[model samples]
Target: MLNLDVVWTSEFAANKWIMPLPADAIPTDKMIPATVNAATYRDTLVGAPYYTDGALFYFRSDLLKAAGIAARPKTWDEMKTACKAILALPAAAGMSCYAGQFDKNEALTVNFSEAVASAGGTVVDAEGKPTVNTPEAKKGLNLLVDGFKQGFFPSDAITYLEEQGRRAFQDGKLVFLRNWPFLHASLSATDGSSKVAGKFGITSIPGTDGPGVSTLGGRNLAISPFTANKATALEFIKFFTSEEQAKKRLALSSRAPAYASLYADPAVVAKRPFFPTLLTSLNNAQPRPKVVQYGATTKAIQEEAYAAITGKKDTDTALNDMQAKLTELSAK
Candidate 1:
């Protein structure tokens, strides 16, 4: 959008694009750093971040308590062990161990990126180099592919996106779910649609060695360059990203605010008890490979990762294929 002249840019603290922002527009000292970095392209400010999002682990606390599990798993290996114990219980009969967004689309790209990143591998480097064939990459890929082959995740999870995975967990079909923050409010609501309300808990996604890296996901507000009223656009942007609106977003929908101080506010913290954990997630999350050809790059990722997960291609073959294809797209 920046390259095509599709949007009007803003100067905000989180601006980091190659396009420069207006001087002395907005001080971004209160916004989260990772979000700012993600919006920045070549040191220019082009967008005002609205909400920041990252992957979170949701699980049945009651199931863990019954399985004699002492706490949430800190690592993927530990989570695997916990899944095994929990699945053995009679109450957990017909239940799958875990679920995530793995359908062959953009969600799969995010899921695959997190797996590789959690194992300390990069799909593509800052210089647009594909790096998906290393030992760390293999370790990460196997965690999901191997798990699928061994029945850790249901074979049907090969078709789940956010809604499908959310429904599976909400219907009490899965023990653990990996999703973005928006699901918290929906699942925790007092309404009758939620079957697991108040029966679950949230935590960081488990990593190979410890906490995993989350693929940053959120929205940034930008005005179109063709807008007739630039001043009005600026005012709207200002009001939308203000601290007051940030608090409103959080309180109304469990939406993570772009401002950092809101995470520490007594009222905000009391309403969203997991703000600290969310802050940590945002701090550690990495944006998707910052390429202009994002659609092509992510399609390359989804194809190979989906093939690997569904047994159509081996992990070694899938990663090798993905690296070659991404390298080709990056060069263009």
Candidate 2:
């Protein structure tokens, strides 16, 4: 048995290193559809969906209330308007508008994919074809590029990874931050380490029109092809992914559960106040490109996306180059 990253499903399946899962025996019916999709490769179910995660929009709620903003922004335009109001306040004097991971690393690929998806575009289509050359894709990439050019994102954000962004938000240096669900516990801590302990709020990341899509992330449980005790492995997998176990895990460790019902459970919500918003983001999440060559695919995205975000290349030129690179990668 192996605990595999969701992005590795296609790679492992293509290499014949993992056996296809017996869908009838697994409790996939109760799992999040996006997680089930992540465990699938070329129409074959290859892994059992495990705990899952998605990006969330983290903001300084107190700042929004002070600005008289009645609700969280659901669209990019609304976010910009809110930023204008919040930044003008004396309390928000040193804060920047927003920030996401933009360094030339794997984080960049995740951020880039979410941007395209939120604008109603895809980095790669369902059939494994590159689709980053469309008008929607351009609009998506422009959100980051234009954000930097307009000073919405801090100038130093080009060097930020997850930790940097989290630190900035926890320190009350940002009005909004795009990050994963795990940050909820840390940011909500009452320790003196968090400057905005009770002042922050979470929602679905804003989109061009409405709520944005997040990049799906999590691990999957798979049976190794060489394992002799296949029956035993399957039994363990069933036990591990069962609803009872999932609920226990969530309660014990705050790990996001794959079971959809847990997100709505009163007890679960009482323990994790962010579950409802997280469920909304997870339902709209898109898996990062599921290809056999995921490593090279993500590298290509990071390079082009970094260039565009840092003003080294215009959005069109960067995405055009990315399209060609992805086209070649898919063909391989």
Candidate 3:
């Protein structure tokens, strides 16, 4: 039997040395939903969640206070004000996600998906119909695209990956950042790697007065169907994913756990300053479409966001095209 389910998770760093554990470590919650288009590995009661991640707002407290802002922005309009405030202050860049650069690209997809849903738009209809061109989707795309074009964020941001953004913000090149939980450790560590240590704050992703939404952006644990020692796997999972471990992940590693029980632990929450904000966003997150076509549709939506912003296409017309593409893609 494998001694432990996950000796090292992809969360800390890419699990290259420990990439493929003998078993799986995924979640079984119906709400978590599967990502692949047609089928998913069984929603097995896989290994315990070491840590999960979601959308988080990264900002520099020094810069914000200097600009006379005392609190995080709560709504989309306020987000605009905050972005503009930071941009107007020389050397403080603001950014959300890369526009339509790559698909399955966690940062871009989650950022765009969350913003769309936060604006009260559903990616798929009740009948599993595609709805990427709905009014809410249009507004969501415009929100980021406008920021991109007008330079609310760094001009080079669209070409950046999550780590690239992390480096930029840590280097003081950016004042506002929207990224995953990993930034927590990278920025706060006493280690000299980050230039902006102990100076940043986190908040829930801003909303638009409609409803706050952020996409699910982390991995869950699952046992492999081929495992010969399921019980051992489960045992290892429990040990590695206990409350104590979870807290360590929050403090030392910056990973979130999916278990509701662990969330109530004071130590766990305390270590992760953004725990409350993440929970709020998690509570409101809309699961991605379950159809086999979901991934392809997401790519289409990315194109729509870019077209509406950089392609010089009419916003309404772009949306219309998106709606059509979604309809065709999601069709049986």
Q: How close is candidate 3 to the true structure, as a TM-score?
A: 0.73
- Candidate 2 per-residue lDDT, tens place, 1-332, comes to 99998889998999999999886978888989999999999888899987999999999999999999999999888999999999999999888999999999989998999889989999999878999999999999999999999999999999999999999999889999999888988898897889999998999999999999999999999999898999999999999989999988875786798999999999999988899999988898889999889999999999999999988999999999999999999998
Query: For candidate 1, lDDT tens digit of each residue in 73-180?
Result: 978889889999999999899999888888899999889989999999988787657899899989988888987988889888988999998888988898999998
Judging by lDDT, tell me the better candidate of 1 and 2. Answer: 2
Q: List the residue pairs that clash in candidate 1.
A: 8-223, 13-28, 16-40, 16-41, 17-40, 17-41, 17-44, 18-41
Tens digit of per-residue lDDT, candidate 3, span 171-237:
7677667777767877886878887787778777776883367666455344454577766765676
Ranked by lDDT, top first: 2, 1, 3
Off by over 4 Å in 3: 1-51, 86-106, 221-253
Model 3, C-alpha of 238: deviation from truth (Å): 8.0
Best by lDDT: 2
Tell me each candidate's TM-score: 0.90, 0.98, 0.73
lDDT of each: 0.80, 0.92, 0.59
Give the lowest summed-lDDT range of ten residues in model 1.
Answer: 1-10
* Better lDDT candidate (1, 3): 1
Count of residue pairs whose backbone atoms collide, per candidate: 8, 0, 11
